[model samples]
Target: MTEPNSKDPAPSPLGRRERLLLAAIAAALGLLLFQLRGGLQPQAPLEQMARRSLELPVALANGRPTILEFYADWCAVCRSMAPAVEAIETKHRGALDVVLLNVDNPRWAAEIERYDVNGIPQLEFFDREGQSVGRSLGGRSLAELDAIATALIAGKPLPRLAGVGSLSQLDVASTPVAGPRSHG
Candidate 1:
């Protein structure tokens, strides 16, 4: 048998063409997985939204107030409000309805319109009958949110902070109002 020549360069561990193709395939798979992850994750279904009108209404109508949080993944305000909302949900567990609505879903456009939501982090309070009783917009502290919930439960108007606007003012047209409305 002829000995291999040491002067000849050894073959690459992987051919250049093969390496490029493998990299391309890997990149494609990575993108596919990134796109599919959201769908694969456990999320509230679109169909369940209709039930919000029915089930949530009934729950609210039965003397159990419901807290509806309209949020979007891209919204900083929504992300900031998440923990406070979670805390409120935990505090009032069996007594109130705490639901999160992803406003990014086109299916929720109608509900968004119905609620006249113009921004992220919209919190709506509904009576057991599903009638909207109160609303608060923007990020709030747990104490601030709890106070709103408390006022709703007691049928009292939300205490107005010196600079903060009322929930009604959070609507699309009213958002231009200047200054912070107090929730205390």
Candidate 2:
């Protein structure tokens, strides 16, 4: 064939439709990668369970109550507990120790198994010697968490059924009321 005319438009690159389709596929792949990366990455700092070393036991041995929370990245209850746990951290700063352990991490997986964490939002209270004094599993409301913290600080036994109750089953009667109700 005759040499391509110099002025001829370079063989049409990808057509508009082809370009659009390629772009769409690229965008879809990008979105998929982003989602996969997010899922694989650790949870956000505020949302992540705190990690502590064995030194935690030494701190507990100093006669302070320690709150140890075991959580996973995909757990909705764990995410819900984030704010309350932070509030507890702030409220009991220096008085009560708080530690978060990510069960997804292999380093703490043994502890997770040892503690028998079958669900998200596993809360364990440790005495001065690092012994587990009490534990509550599943979701907990702010008030219930506060009560548990208070009990830990006071060296009193945490109510067995207090924070472990299902949210669907929680009712006005289940909550602890401080003031007398007015029937009038």
Best by TM-score: 2
| Candidate 2 C-alpha lDDT tens digits along 1-184 | 7887888777667889999999999999998988876756745644343643224556568777888877655666777777888788779776788888765555554566678766667778886566788888787877887887888888888756643543222122332333445221
Compose the digit string of candidate 1's lDDT tens values, residues 109-179. 56778887876677788765667776777777778888877876666777663433222222344322222
Clashes of each: 12, 1
Q: Which structure among the candidates has the greatest lDDT?
A: 2
The count of backbone overlaps in candidate 2 is 1
My TM-score estimates for the predictions, one after another, are 0.58, 0.60
lDDT (Cα atoms) of all candidates against the true structure: 0.64, 0.68
